[model samples]
Target: MSGSILNLFSLQGKTAIITGGTGGIGLAITTALAEAGANIISIEVPHDPASPLLRQAIEATGRKITVYDCNLKDHESIRATFHAIWASGSVPDILVNCAGITRHMKVEDTPVQDLDDVMAINFRGTYLCIQEFGRELLRLQRPGKIINFASIAAFLAQTNISAYCSSKAAVQNLTRAVSNEWAGKGITCNAICPGFIHTKMCEDLYTDKEFSARVVARTSMGRWGEPEDIRGLAVFLASAASDFITGESVFVDGGIMGR
Candidate 1:
């Protein structure tokens, strides 16, 4: 079944919708899916263009990367972006919800707006995108995949970022709820729970030698995860290889959870 197995992981002729696909872990996932043979449609904020290096990387994969500007925090913007994507004649086969934000503040000190902002983008945005993606798939009677970007915080609470932790927890369960409703409709929903990956989101913590050392010591692998560490699973979950999987949260941590 070697050949069949390879075929299962192939994404030829597929199109993927990836939010925040210009940088960091999102960019990693975009390149991975493209290299696996899928065309990409990225949704980013206005005025945020993919860097030349990133554009070249995707171009080198012999796949196209088209970006649309949308404010994930805005309901109308999300809907309009999807409509624009469909109007452009691309039928997305996969959806990767990789955009989110966090702030390091004590719950008592965090303003209500801060918590709302975190939830607006991390949880509500994910749900809205999934809502739009699911509608199109169901309307066309097609099979598709959804890969949500959850965090280790979803499983284990962390210090000073209560809002982010709670939002991710919501996303983890949202994956299950979505799968239960849409799995029978030829759509698969799941999440990727990253543990201490070396991305911009964790830069603040990583620069602190003491905290970084503590993270490394706690993780069984004795190292932090790189963005590229997510490539294989991103492709697998986006391809037919994971057809039997849904409502699951797979970790790409460097054995952090194992300890």
Candidate 2:
């Protein structure tokens, strides 16, 4: 029984393609997967400034690493990237869609282009990656896992980030829609809804003492969540432990939703 349980979390033979792996939470997830024995394929947009540091860190783990410059909004580019992965003879067993963007403007002041930009990366990009990965898994007749990044904003509204909130809400449902369509074919799709995690994305907001105190006071944990707070769940969702879980949006929001 102990051996069987241990096997549940083992990712020894899996390969993972993680979008936005150079980012804070994404890098933490990548490290967690590597520690559990999965090879890493870190994908980012072209000329990402953080890639070099991320590559070095992943290298320190002694796990296999491949870097791809992928633009998820461009269907042609996405197809090519997946094709290149297949050509390398390392089909992905897991995909972590952590790539997203946000614009901090109220609906009244937000420009149309900004909304479109957020949707292009956060919504359209996630959908395309899921679609392409599902195709590849279907072609190979392999069971696969897909983890999408939603946010606490998917359920609750906050100020000045309407575009981001809307995109995440779409992603929350997209996870369900994809699971309904693909679960019978041996793919499990799910989303992780995180709250005010301390990432580069939230640096400015978290630095504001007044706003920070308000969030912390409201949070059941009374502290901001760190990137590392997300890694353990990521490993579980990507492993055999969560084979029965699909089409669900799990919250890692420090009880924000409960409140």
**Candidate 2 lDDT, 28-94, residue by residue in tens:** 9898899888999987899999998888877888888898888877878888998898898988699
Candidate 1, 1-259: lDDT as tens digits? 7988899999999999998787689888899999999998888888775655556778999999888889999999999999999999999699999999998999889999999899999999999999999999999999999999998899889989999999999999999999999999889999999999888778988999999999999888898999999999999999998998999999888888776
Q: What do the candidate models score in CA lDDT, each in turn?
A: 0.92, 0.91
Q: What local lDDT does model 2 show for residue 106?
A: 73
> Model 1 segments beyond 4 Å from truth?
49-51
